[model samples]
Every structure is written in structure tokens, then in C-alpha cells.
Target: MRGELTAKGRATRQRIIEGAAAVLRERGAALATLDDIMARTGTSKGQLFHYFPAGKDELLVAVAQFEADQVLEDQQPYLGCLDSWEAWQQWRDVVIERYEAQGDECPLGSLFFQIGRSTPGTRAIVIELLRQWQESLAAGVRALQGAGLVPADVDADIRAAALLAAIQGGVSILLSTGRSTHLRAALDQGIADLRGTSHAAV
Candidate 1:
């Protein structure tokens, strides 16, 4: 649907999606309604349907995508540049801060829960999100190698995958326990281990 939109149409659709995302985050996926979204976005029912032909389920998927993008966007310049130990630490802090500020309420998780995680659209969103996240981490590792902070023999992809897994595990715990302890530990330990690679290379 979005692929066919003109510039103004695309902007309107994006506005609706962002508005829906905000409504979902505030009221949750289970309770939010089309009327709520319409009111929030100031969009008419016809306009909404024109943008999202399948109704609420389709809209939810769009919002899920938005939230997923935000997950990586929150990591920003720090994630983009991991050439130094300080940069890695800063990135780690941003991750912790972002999740901690979110504090157990996961808008993306809620959207997936409402949309059904196994649904093709929702699953693709999740897969793409993880793929991009892992690639960024791997790129960061590569940057370290480029800077001679990590050995040439070190496997960037493997380290990125492991670190990504650790972060996910920690986030799962945070969602369940409402604490960032595990997340902080995961990040701290992961960076520390990456730094260890530098020593071993020396």
C-alpha cells in the first residue's frame, strides 16, 4: 500500500503510523482502537482504510515496523562508530539508557503480541530488525579491527551474534523483572570481552 503512495500520501501515511504507534504505546495494543488512532492522528476512517486496507491488524503491523526501526535509531551515532573502546562504552550506555527509559513496556512486543508473532508480516519485521541490528554490531566489530583494536583473525560476525544474543537475553529479563541489571552486565561483559581481544592481539 505504501509503495504506491505519492510524496504527500507517503507523508500522511507515515503520520498515521507514527500517531498509531504513540497511541499503542500509551494505551497498549490490546486496548487501542481504530477510533483512538483516528483521533490521535486526526485521520478519517476512509483515509485510514485507504492507507491500511486490512484495518487494525494491518495498521498494527505498520506501527510494529515503526517501533522496530526506533529500536536501532535509539542507538544512533555511537552504534554507527565503534572504532574505539570509548565509543563502544558510549554505545553501551545509550543502549542501557534507552531500554531503561522504556522500562519494561515494549511497544514492539505489544504490537507483535496483538498481531501474533508468527504472522508473516510481524515475523518479517522481527527478522529484518534483528538482521539490521546484528549487521550494525558486526560492522562495529569490523570498525574495531580496522582501528587495530581487534585482531585480524577475530570473527566479527560471530562476536556480533553472541553480543546480540546476550543483549536480547538481558532485555527479556528486563521485561520480566523490571530491572536493567542483567542488561548492564551483558553489555559491560560483552564490551570487556571485546577489549580482551585487543590485549590478546598485542
Candidate 2:
């Protein structure tokens, strides 16, 4: 009996969570409501409250996680297989295209900002996103090293972290100014640094 009840509850909760994310995306977090989720998911008020007893705040956390998952998801394939120069370039283009298309409407960033990323839950999500992103990038750098494309002593973690930081800075500026110059520069420099085969290395 308990097992069956738990499964049903989990399903209901996931439904509400997804519904809330859609609402937040379509209407923005500031305007999302319980009814909006109910309408989207066909769930009732009772169910929403059952899943997110704290109401919109709890649901927003779930949405934040969803968005964070998407940040990594958007860069799959190439991100997971940065084993070649071609793959790294493809990953870089994917990252640029994703952000460029989004322009200023960063739903994921909006969700975190609305909920206060400094909060423990949101902060953990942010940290987890960075950790996974950096890990993938670092793996790519290590792959390059193994390919004889970079010095074997290259510190993958530092390079990846620096590259990720530059990307974030570029994105933030792009979000503010609606320009891709910084994004382009960051990617070009990051890739150049990784390539290290350039005469600039001397």
C-alpha cells in the first residue's frame, strides 16, 4: 500500500514540477501562478500543494534545477566527447549559438535571480552546474593532451575553469549589452589557448 501510494505521489509531483516550469518560461517567474500550473498540467490545487507544500517557491526550485539540467543538456554530444579539435570547435559553436539565440531572455538566469541564487538550494544548483560544466571541459582538455595537441603537463582543471569563467563573463556581458563580440572573443581566445600549437605559444 505504501509503495503504491509513494509511486503515485511521485508521479503527481513531477507533473506539477514540469507544469510550473512551463508556466515560468512562458509567463516569466514573476507572473507564474498555481492556476497556471494547474491549467498546464491538468493537476488540481490539492496536488500542487501536496507536491510543493511551500507553494510557488518550492516549485521554482524545481524549475531552477530543470533549467540547470538544460544548461548542460544544450551542450551534449560535443561536451561529452571533446576528444578532438573538431569536437571542441563544435562545442564552442553550440555554446555560442545557444546563448546568442536566447538573447536577453535567459529563463534559467531569471529563475535563479528571482529565487536568490545565494540561497543554499539555488547555490548548490549553481555550483553543481559549474562543476559538471567544468568537468566536461577539463575532460576535453585532457583528451587533447592525450592526442599530443597540448603539453602533457597542462593542468586541465585550471584551463577548463578559466575557459568556463571567460564564457560566463562573455554571456553576462552579452545579456546586458545584446552583443556577441565578447562571446566570440572569449571562445576564440579559449580555443587558441587550448590549441597552443599556434606561434603565439612562443
What TM-score, over all chains together, does every model reach?
0.97, 0.91
Per-residue lDDT for 1-202 in model 1, tens only? Answer: 5688999999999999999999999999999999999999999999999999999998898899999999999999888878888999899999999999999999999999999989999999999999999999999999988988889889999999999999999998999999999999999999989889878768
The top-ranked prediction according to lDDT is: 1
lDDT of 2 by residue, 1-202 (tens): 2244487787777777777787888898878777888999998788777777787888898889988998999999899999988998999899999999989788888898889869998999999999999999999999887887777777899999999999999999999999989998999999987787434433
Candidate 1 is scored at a TM of 0.97
Overlapping backbone residue pairs in candidate 2 total 0
What lDDT score belongs to each candidate, Candidate 1 first? 0.92, 0.86
Model 2 / residue 100 / CA error / Å: 1.0
For candidate 2, report its TM-score.
0.91
Ten contiguous residues with the weakest lDDT in model 2: 193-202
Global Cα lDDT for candidate 2: 0.86
- Please give the lDDT score at residue 169 for candidate 2: 93
